[model samples]
Target: MTESQPHLLFSFGTLLDRQVQTALFGRTVATTPAALAGYATRPLAITDEAVIATSGQDVHLTLERRLGSTVEGAVLRLTDEELAAADAYEVADYARRQVLLTSGETAWAYLDANPLRSAARIVIVGDSIAYGRCDPQGGWTGHLAAAHIAANETQNRVFNLAVPGSTLADVSAQTPALLPPRHPDTLIVAAGINDSAVPLAAPGDGHDGLAHLTGHLDSLAATARRHNARLVVVGPVWLDETRTGDYEGLRFTTDRALALRTALRAWCADHHIDFLDLWEPLRDQPHLLVDGLHPDAAGHKELHRHLDALG
Candidate 1:
């Protein structure tokens, strides 16, 4: 017989019930005994009628963080499609996250969902584009912050620490704000455009520029891991060279932007972090760029829509 694909899931609740398993997966799944350390189980009231009917229970066990505690469970190997079914079976009261088991295995487990209950702080650091220079609505970050406030999630904080014309090094300097008691739950970086801008009279290829930006990104990723925060890298936007060419001592070209965007995408993939690519999406829409550089209000709105979709 062929072995199941490697989508390990650790379950300690209704998923263990034979009937529930059959109802959800159309068959009883084989499971190996396992235990999740550093967590305890608590009752989570389920109000979803469909979920309650499928699980045949109104209350289910949910995982909660507690030092020195462990929740006994079983590991079930599932295919990607089966995993999606499991996700569908889970209620909104739970959020899935990867965890290390006492058996020296890593698996996905559902825990109590708390983003709505506990306000999450998001910190954005970048340059003029991230700072909403040309947009009256304060760019995409500003739109995100405003939406949170308008939704009555007052405790949910969004900090935009972008500086106009800042490069990767300058943004790296701004990461100090992510330390200690004010550590953000998420960090969003919207940079690279400024770094891609080369002096019109500069010599040699821009290989050094790519390396420098990527190195800073590596450091930022390490910092996010240390703080147990999620890191998202936003790629550079397309520039209209007709209006921006040689305006200053520096030159902004589409080729440089494409190179940086590709680099950012690859780095994010290798590091298993989130990346938002804005090049192709905004390239054809020259009207979005107010001054052939910064995005206008409508463009900012478009950016916000994409970012929000990431969730």
Candidate 2:
């Protein structure tokens, strides 16, 4: 981006301290009440002497994700420069990701982006979320792929294998052909909305929709294991009220959205996959959906913010 513009930011830790906030940005910023979904705060001791001294405390709240918890915090309308300042104040233990607040607004927040390894060969397989059926500006993965290409660090490379409307069932059957001869070292699978669609109450084939979906997930996991690749799965997001009607023919609903997240969580547990369950964070932020489905340009930034941290 030509100098990333200002964005909304959510802080759950010491950044809440006016002293620490002022020390970093040289002024106290006006903040409003806001909260992060699916996160809980616990005491973590600060090892950095400077941070301890500056904030006048060694114990600060560190965040962990739990399905039913929330992290109450202050929301700052920050300029790009202020965000950079905040980044400098956080220790290596913290990384940034975007979150949809309970306020129906999306904002960047500091989260753990711990990875076993920095990805070198990335293969993305999914429907429009991966394909970016989005705002005129485009999708988050597109920007992520571009950043990796530009950096040329870690010998990073991206293979965009996503096609609009393709689900796990389609991907499972087609993966062998979909992958390039140069296999991926890291696989990112983000698909569900398309699969959740019933397409006119036609959930076909005499099986529970959720159960059948998990079977397809198994095929996806098997393919990734065959490549000896690290797997990451992003879950379905909350849809918009207006967009809900369009899927009437497709048999998709917010309830189906919940089923998809639950199935993905179970599947990830069974297979030891890294899962980014978006349903929790995006559940209350239906306004972020652009076409009642996909994230708009800013929402794409929100999604990419989480995915980019994988690097």
Candidate 3:
């Protein structure tokens, strides 16, 4: 729609933030709280950052009728100039499309487009952090979503398929059955911390440390290439230093976390995948975390900055 087209822009998550809205969309657009249907939002833990998700994890994704339960959000009505500016901001990851409102009428708006629908799907597959745990905003999922929303005002659907405590074996087990037959436009994998926590001496270990991590990452890259999706490998967030419980009968420390990050980065660079060293900026910011495991409010803010840097 043209800037003067009297458009309705649907906003969720950080875009819901008044300050963030004013900063990005300008003051001319009128925003009314609104929601979309068939989805619930959750947080992903990756340092302290604001990210959210509508799918994946233990959260039951509600697949109601196209006119089912509504997600509350702001309906931004903007002048042509404001809309144009908003479009520029959102052209990275989202696109404008008409959606069936709860009333069964089509309202022109923006939504995530399935990469397969146009180019290829870019999938984010990982564990609790990738699924968003601490920030309650789905961590990078929220960042990716907001950025996607801003980057691709033309509409591109991004999918996050991560589960808490998910092991490399879990992904391997599910890939054949759950993954789409085709590759995605991009594939991001954030995992291995929980798996590494398992004591190496344990019998019947679920993941084999570097070997497992390397294998799984390789598999992910192969799958992405098969589907023609850009592959990105994200490093794990550090453990909550305050919470020291026996993980697989072993102790965890910052050194261990840093080692993991190093390994993952090496693998990504070696494999020629897009790597986001999410840990470097915030790994030292332990105070930004919640319960030593997830990112606190400050952490989420820092994460947003990192994501912005990637852009």
TM-scores of the candidates in the order shown: 0.65, 0.59, 0.55
Task: Give candidate 3's total backbone clashes.
Answer: 61
1 or 3: which has the higher lDDT?
Answer: 1
Task: Tell me, by TM-score, which candidate is best.
Answer: 1
- Residue range 35-92, candidate 3, lDDT tens digits: 5554333332222122222111221211111112356666776666666665554433
At residue 118, candidate 3 shows an lDDT of 31
Kindly provide the TM-score of model 2 when superposed on the true structure, using C-alpha atoms: 0.59
Kindly list the per-residue Cα lDDT of model 1 for residues 193-306, writing each as its tens digit.
888888777646554566687779988876765554556788988888787777467788888888989989998877656677777656778899887888899988888777
Worst 10 residues of 3 by lDDT: 58-67
The best-first sequence of candidates by lDDT reads 1, 2, 3
lDDT of residue 184 for candidate 3: 41
Best by lDDT: 1
Q: What lDDT does each candidate get?
A: 0.76, 0.71, 0.57
Model 2's lDDT to the true fold? 0.71
